[model samples]
Target chain A: MTIEIIIQAIISGLLMGFIYALIAAGLSLIFGLMGIVNFAHGEHLMLSMFSSFWLWTLLGLDPIISIPITMLILAISGILTHYLLIRYILKAKMIVQICATFGLSVFLRSLAQFLWTPDFRNVGNPLLEGRLEIAGIFIGQPQFYASLVCLLSFLLLYLFVNKSETGLALQATAQDRKAAETLGINSNKMFALGWALGLSCVSIAGTMMSNFFFIFPDVGVHFALFAFVAVALGGFGSIIGCLIAGIIIGLVESLGGLLIDPSYKLLYVFLIYLIVVIYRPQGLFGR
Target chain B: MNNNLQKAKLEPVWHTNKFIFALIFFLVTLFFFFPFINPSNFQLHLMIMIFMYAVMAQSWNVIAGFSGQISLGHVIFFGIGGYTSSFFYVEYGITPWIGIFIGILFSSLVAIAIGIPMLRLTGHYFAIATLLIGFSFQIIFQRWDLIGAASGLWIPLNWDNPWLTLQFHESKIPYYYIFLIFFLLSYFSIWIIYRSKIGFKLRAIRDDPQAASSLGIPVAKYKIIAFVISAIIMSPMGSLFAQYILVIEPERMFDIEISIIVLLIAVMGGVGNVWGPLIGTIILIPLSEYTRIFFGGTGGSVDLIIYGILIMLICIFRPSGLISFFPKKILERKKFL
Candidate 1:
């Protein structure tokens, strides 16, 4: 009711917004790169969370400290996915393309469940803990650090995408695969790089989330759905659009939950995508 | 060049000769007496499952395969069929037979509303939009308490007049026969469409809407028609499934997994053909059912893993689906073919 509570909500929403943007980054990148939705994108998130959790458990490393290792692990899996599954289906029917990834999603989720039961596991006592209150606005330390890391990663990714030569070639390939190939760019390598880069984004997001979110085989499912909405609202392949849309979603979720019913919070997030679909099928920022 | 290609596409269907008709009749007759032999209850259950899924997949084919717009959220109509029927039946004491019609009507209206806008978007956009809509429905139905909320709805056990209520406690045979009839009717409808101009026009849109529109086809009208047909096929089955199981949960009914399974059956068995869904269900259902029966007790998800792999392998190796494995000579029209 008061301005202080609304301010608190905005601050908290902003922090979670960064994480959501980070979570959506990889999905947007892959879709922009190859036009494949990566139905298993959520499973990749689940895997990265598990990887970070296990790293913490077995190696006695803090989730933050093991971010690089988890990113590496996820990047390799991404490379493997590109080589083993995606490349073959890239030119196939739409249904084939959809099913191949959908199957991979189902396969990976169950495999994770089979290997490490579906029971939720938490990273207890991560290096980040406690809450900070500044000017009557409360922020959890873990959420703050998570947002800070996500923002930093997004900036780094932006640089790599825009400033780097390989990134430009990647963009060229995404614009037109055959044209890029004619220009001596190996579309295959670009695709592989896209996968590695995409999964790495998921890994970073997952590692950050591991500090606060429960680690489970199905944990990524929720994030994956949210990422879909973010990608759609932001326009596929638009990084800035993703960030803005993610923030909007985060604010709407928090405000909707506060002003209305909590259980129906997700309804508002999805409604935004529906609105985007009807009014701007090209997405809010899509060309 | 285009004319020849069009001829080629149209010539493959319409093989309705006496022998083929007799063969189909013989096979249907054989299947009709199948339950009379008193097969094991498990086998009967499997057949029923196959018929149910076959019909669903074929229904989905009207939109996805023929029109070439994949709706990953096809389960929404199924959920609509189920929730509407069960709510009326469980609360108002309305018979499911009438409820089924209402469910069908609801789904058709929903299809018209959703299809007009969504069908305009092509390929991935359509798929993604439908998927989000489907998820939204799940969330809505899960929270709506009038239909039992998340706990789901169940028809009180009323075996007194099972026939009227669409619930038969006497045997699984009645369900099997009913489902078989549904399957045959659905197949017949699809078969009729397959030989009709609407089928050709749909496939034309599937290949290229621009080209179809250039030919003066009412692209918009046919697309919505396809969507409505698909919804109509899927809706009643949901009601029947609810009646058979005597339970209707929003989560189970609206799960994306159901959509995936239906797509798998249609795609792996050969889409763009009348027999594709039946072939897909016959192969997929039993494998999944058996795997779950044997290896799923510990919640291992072994069946799902296998199911996933099978779909991937089939999609990669046989993207045209298993029906293509048959001799092309036999599939084509003219002579015995």
Candidate 2:
């Protein structure tokens, strides 16, 4: 109710929103271009988190530095996933694609559980341990750094997509694969690039989350649902829409939790999702 | 009606079938009632759990399998039923039997409202929408202190007075039989619907909604109707399960996991095919129970991995589900396929 409390909530919401946007941007891009809802999208993020945790524990690397490593690894993993599994379902029905990806999600989650033993692991990053005090509001140093990283990533992504040839091809494929093929673009390569880029987004978000958030096998399910809600809120397939929607949802969660229990935060956001889908199936920013 | 008679005659004979559903049913029923035939309390408890699961799966199959909506929030209806019956039982001493009807009514009404909005969404959106509604219901239930909130409410476990709304005796055999009857009735109701005109509309919509709509079928109306009818059957499932478990917690009644299990079974069995869920339950339920027994708490999602693999195989190889495993001659002869 007070200005300080509101300011603190807004700060928290904006930071969380950036993280949501970072993770969801890839999902939006892949879904837009491929018309496949990658249920394993969050699993990619989970893998990054685990990798970051291990890197931190073993080599004493900061999560921020581990970000690039995770992104590169995930990019390769994403391409391989598409080449091996998702490529076959490109021409198949949407339900088939959905189930295929959902299967991959389960498989990846099980693999993580088998490997990690379901223990919560943290990235040992000293930078992440610091906090900032601004006008009576305390914000974690890692979160602020993550926010800056998210903004920079978004800007860099925007440039790559808008100013680069491969990005143009990816956009063209997303707009219409058949048309993009007519332009002598290798649509498969474009799809692979899109997939890799999507995973990179997940990697960055995962690294950011691992700094503070505990890494677990099923964490992807939680974030994936929230990302879906964000995508739905923003209008599916719209990057700008996802950005806006992610912020709105982040505010909704942080502020709504003040009125109700935190456990019901997702439930309330889902209600918004239902209402949005019911009223505008195309989403707020979807075309 | 004419087609109904033809389909009725097309029922696969128990002897001709390799699965022997009738024998299995009888054996399972007898096993559940074996305690009553002799008298053992612990074995009877397991029977009650099995019966509850059987009925729960049946209710889920109606919408997820029959209507092909693929809802992941069926536990919402179960929660509605449980809370409705529990609230009335505790406050007014109303028998849960009567309270069950009120539960069904409330559940159906809410389902229609949600369905009316969600039926527009296809595939994953529909699934997510239902999940949201289920989650919302859980939140509301947990927050409303009248229903005991997070602490949960305990219904009196009286045995002697059978006339009371909810009670249990020395033996759990009667509960098992009662659930068996409910399961049979649920199966029969779905069967009848499958053979009915409405069932045809539902299947047509599931196969191809645009084509069905083009053929003058009221697609939206039928989908909502299917949800309503499914809720009517499923709500009582909650009441029965709550009574059997001797308690109803919000999370247990409206668990997201329950919805996933239901969808997983239906998808594994061969969605849109009658007896698919039953067959799936027969195969997978026992395996799951065994996993629980073997690994205890250690086995987090080993079974889920198996189920996920099965779903992938089915979606890739045989989207028609286990029903495709039946012999060609039987499928051709029945013509009910």
Candidate 3:
């Protein structure tokens, strides 16, 4: 392949990877804190996308303007989800925990379909509409902004988790719930906060994606699948790992699509996932 | 722990019990006569769907429930079975009756290939791996033009010959009977495994793989065995599903939703048990159907919403399954009293 084509693919892939990392970081955080894989995580993303779509369509708000609103809405829903459904199943069997989230996913997807219908919706004349040409390469404004927002949020989340006291307390809770509780860090509240933060990340991703992609109940499925792979590949419960893995997946997917057939892009991602899972079950950055 | 283990081992075999015998007899008779009861075509179709799903769920339960290896990609085998059988019939003009066996073989081989590596991962990792595998299958099948690509393959219509092509024209009765037979075969195989030494080995591994391995259970081998058996039983359902629907698309055949639904049914009924899938299918199919009929318009997702709610509630309140609602004395026959 020409150097130009390779550069173009890498640029786009890295941008896509940032978005994947944002989504997967939330998933990894929740799993790290609660030890529960939220099967409905995709649904949460879908809901955010739908919310963005609605805000743009009904209220004539740009997706960029709707980002905060989407994040707030999804964060609350995430907290509510933990309280209403996840809390009850915390002590249940592994299968039960899985079923709870899986069921929630089905419920949310169906609810979206019921309320909004299955028709694909998109933001009309999004703020970032044109493509920017740089060095004989073109980048869609939406994609560039999405990647920028994703990187900024990733930085904020990293700072919040690593630098802030509350983030340390959250980490303590994730490390050892009982020990954290004994230290006067309410593990339950921490768990809820983790969910809120995690979902808010997804909300940002949805809002950014709404600028360029079609919004539908099932839109979350493919992205969610990629996020899952990213989380697993990066190592469960590791945010930095998720970011690195997400970028790797994005690169592989984009490059694979360009080099091989675009239709088999997912196949390439899955192949990499399988290889990582089989060879290094602990994941690239997992403890 | 030893006492409980002994008690588990000492659980009574109820095959000779009059109630058990009567129940088996009644079910067999019902299976035979249900098609002839003159139910509406819609009802028959529903029954076929229920039976097909139950078989699939039961197969899934063998690995997930009994062996404690949660596989979210069981639909991969099902899809393989469907595609294999369909390809055999379409390309070679072979009867599906024989093609079904080849499909089962193909599915078992694929299952083993997946299970050997995947079964090593515990719990959620395994689940995620399987889920990815299913998605990969979908993508591969969608792009593979040999299998008719995204549009999928339709079994040619043959009204004159019901026995050869496995097509019954407009009648749903034959499909119902075929699915029923497949369901019974799956149930009986599961029942045998549950009672056999293999079932105990699987349960042992499920409870504690380290302990089971220490006890010389050959843990990995047995898990593979369980996985293969599960895939073998599941393949026929896919084959029959292709015949019943007369249309097989990669997306529909290898849909992650199919895997989720089967897992839900098995878990909802009672995982790792012989009757769990059947009980689950009995409840879910009709529930989904009724919801679809009543809420035909205005965005028809009522059934899924309800199904989702029921799953969450069940997981929270009764994680063991709906079967747990029954008296332990009757279901378990522990100490016979």
Candidate 4:
């Protein structure tokens, strides 16, 4: 109805987009490295939120302060996932690869419900709890901060993957695992590193998200769905593509929810994804 | 090639000695007489479920297993099947028999529309697209008011005309027999398909679409055909299942769990094989149902956790499935037949 409302929605959507991109970055990185689309990526996000919530409650740590700890926790789980399950099914059929992660998702979702009792929980009083108005547009402090932090994390990940020697080795593995191995790079270590980096990226986003979003067992499902779309739409293995795609999805979701019925916002996003996949199988920015 | 085709037709794969005939007759007889044994209501319910899922899984198998296009969100058709027939039966006072045919027709058209675009994308792209489509349909059905909205449709009990309504009020016997007949017919049809050229061509498509296409098989057309066939196989069951339960909710109809369970059943029994879905359902469905009955399925997702673990383990350790455990000679059809 008003320009101010549209701007307000855009700002908030952009903020959420950064978080979505970070989540999609994890999925993209995993798929890029070993061609496995971690279906449990959503649960990893759920666990991270839970970890952040518990840290805030028990240790009185702000989500900002607890970001490192949560990242470490999720990174360790990512490694465990690789070493325990993924390493075995790397060369298995696509359905097996899918089912393994899908199974992990179901397991983690149920485990969370079993452990924390499926009740919606949230950070009681975050250190950052306010909104700021800029040029006739309002932005929540939590969302703005989360967006900034997510952007910062994304920059770091981009740097780590593009500039660092290990990062390039990880790239090398992704491009050609056998060639990378022949060149004396430990493809396995790079793979494990890929998972670690990937999950840690999401953990940061998840922690930031917990500051504002509801913390629940099934909270990750919608986010994970968005991440999957982002990963696919960005071309399965492109990190930068996921970032751009994530932002596009966020905008689409916000604008679509504004223009269309709010309930069908996600439907529009999926429609976009379907159109893209059907028309352009290589994705918008395929590697 | 010509001779092989003729031989296949002349000597169908299932022909065997009288001993096999007697065994088949005995098993059919036993299945028919199951309700007479005064079994627990739960047992009867379990059998009906097994039969129902066998149909669902095998239908899933036609596309996912044989065609090699893993559709993770396959329950969309099931939801479509259930909702369409239930809507007509409840609103127009029409018999479900006619409604079932309409459902099949409607779902086939839907599968065609979806499959043409969707089947063009292979492997993970196809799988995830179908998954999203499925979830999208669930969201739509949950909000759409015409088909009874989110709360779902409850078919009124037709005490006077149970047969016409496809609702059996007094006993589960009718549902069991009806589903058993369906299950057998479904299996028989699939068995025929598996032995026919279409079956071999589907298997070829499953193994490698590019190679199959190179060999002059119409890969895309065949994939769509398999996709529609799979949807057709799953369609009628929705009507029957809605009738059996007497309650059809969008949430219940299009649950991702149904899609996953169907996949788990197909994969665990052995993918790309006719016997696979039934075998998987036989072993896994009962275990799952019993777990729900024993462990309070009310409070938490204890069942999902189990299913997840079972699927993961099956994928990891026994990727070929449980059917592989049987001696090759019994289940394995002859090569070059």
Going through the candidates in order, their DockQ values are 0.75, 0.52, 0.87, 0.80
i-RMS of candidate 4? 1.2
For model 4, state the Cα shift of residue A105 in Å: 1.1
Backbone atom clashes (below 3 Å) for every candidate = 0, 1, 0, 0
- Residue A72 CA displacement from its true place in model 4, Å: 1.2
Interface RMSD of each: 1.4, 2.3, 1.0, 1.2
User: Whose lDDT is greatest here?
Assistant: 3
Q: How displaced is residue A64 in candidate 1, in Å?
A: 0.7
Tens-place lDDT per residue, model 4, B273-315, is: 8888888998888887887877765644776778788888888
Cα lDDT of model 4 by residue, A1-287, tens digit: 99888887787788889999999999999999999989888999999999999999998999999999999999899999999899999999998898799889988999899888888999978988999988778889999999899999999999999999999999899999999999999988888888999999889999998999999999998899999899889999988998899899999999889977899988999998998987888888895
Off by over 4 Å in 2: A110-120, A135-137, A179-189, A258-264, B1-55, B162-169, B332-337
iRMS, candidate 3, in Å: value is: 1.0
Residue A56 deviation, candidate 4, in Å? Answer: 2.5
If you assessed candidate 2 against the hidden native complex, which CAPRI class would it receive? medium
Q: Give the range where candidate 1 chain B is weakest over 10 consecutive residues by summed lDDT.
A: B8-17
lDDT of 1 by residue, A1-287 (tens): 99998888888888888888988888999999998988898999999999999999999999999999999999999999999889999999877888789889989998898889899999999999999989778889999999999999998998999999998999999999999999999999999999999999999999999999998888877788789889989998898888998899889989889888889888898888888878898888988
In candidate 4, position A194 carries an lDDT of 89
Look at candidate 4 and tell me the lDDT of residue B308: 82
